[model samples]
Target: MTDSTIWWVLAGLVVGAELLTGTFYLLMVSAGLIGAAIAAHLGVSLPFQIAVAALLGGGLSVALRFYRKAAAAKNPLSKTDGNLDVGARVMVDAWATDGTAQVKYRGANWVAMPVTGETPTPGMHQIEEVVGSRLLIKKL
Candidate 1:
């Protein structure tokens, strides 16, 4: 087969693999293959075709990495309860002198501490954050 035909076939395979893996990296490489195919169709030399493909794929991958990093930094994942326990109601039977109490949560006793609003009395409270084995709570 011709070089351009091979490049197009390779690009199609990479794109198909990317679909199965759900990753954009393979798609970036596929874009490079497509660029190489275009160069080959334009009668470019074999080395120039390879260079075009490598530059397009590698540049896209690096650019995507930086974009992903910046996006993650802009919207960081919150580790507080991971949205599983936070905002859940917990019954605080009593509070100790230090504003901490033993509360049953998720079928187990957990150390609960007040982090916002009024100090928790013997009543229901909302879990604001889960710090280690302790639950940071606030008045409901």
Candidate 2:
């Protein structure tokens, strides 16, 4: 197939991978492939086409990373519903330091932790945040 055809197929593959994974990685690369296609169509050589694709893709990925970071930094909890129990109350059943901790929240046993200014004891605890299936808790 022609260079353009190959580039188009690559772009399609990138988009497909992005769709399947719901990640921005391949999507950005696919956009770079589109740019490469443009260059190829403009009579650029294979090396130039490949270089452009790599440069554009890498540049976009880095820029997007920084952009996302900046945006997130600007609004540290703008989109979260605070689902991590940022400021909720619960009851601690055990202490979880470097591993796992159990707690009771809404009559449900959940993993929790003690906040920096509070202590972790049985009974009531205020959930400061959630740490990936575990909760960062403090005394209520």
Highest TM-score model number:
1
Per-residue alpha-carbon lDDT of candidate 2 for residues 1-140, written as tens digits (9 for 90 to 100): 78988899999999998999999977889989999998988989999999999999989999999999999788777423557556777655666575446766667777665657565567776666676777776676
**Candidate 2 Cα misplacement greater than 4 A, ranges:** 78-81, 88-140
Backbone collision tally, model 1: 0
TM-score of every model versus the real structure: 0.72, 0.62
Clashes of each: 0, 3
Q: How does residue 116 of candidate 2 score in lDDT?
A: 72
lDDT of model 1 at position 20: 99
lDDT of candidate 1 at residue 2, scale 0 to 100? 93
Candidate 1 error regions (>4 Å): 81-84, 88-91, 95-120, 131-135
**For candidate 2, what is the lDDT?**
0.78
Q: For candidate 1, give the lDDT of residue 83.
A: 68
Q: Tens digit of lDDT per residue, candidate 1, span 1-140?
A: 89999999999999999999999999999999999999999999999999999999999999999999999888876765246888899999889998899999889999999986675678888988888899998887
As for candidate 2, its clashing pairs are 113-137, 114-137, 115-137
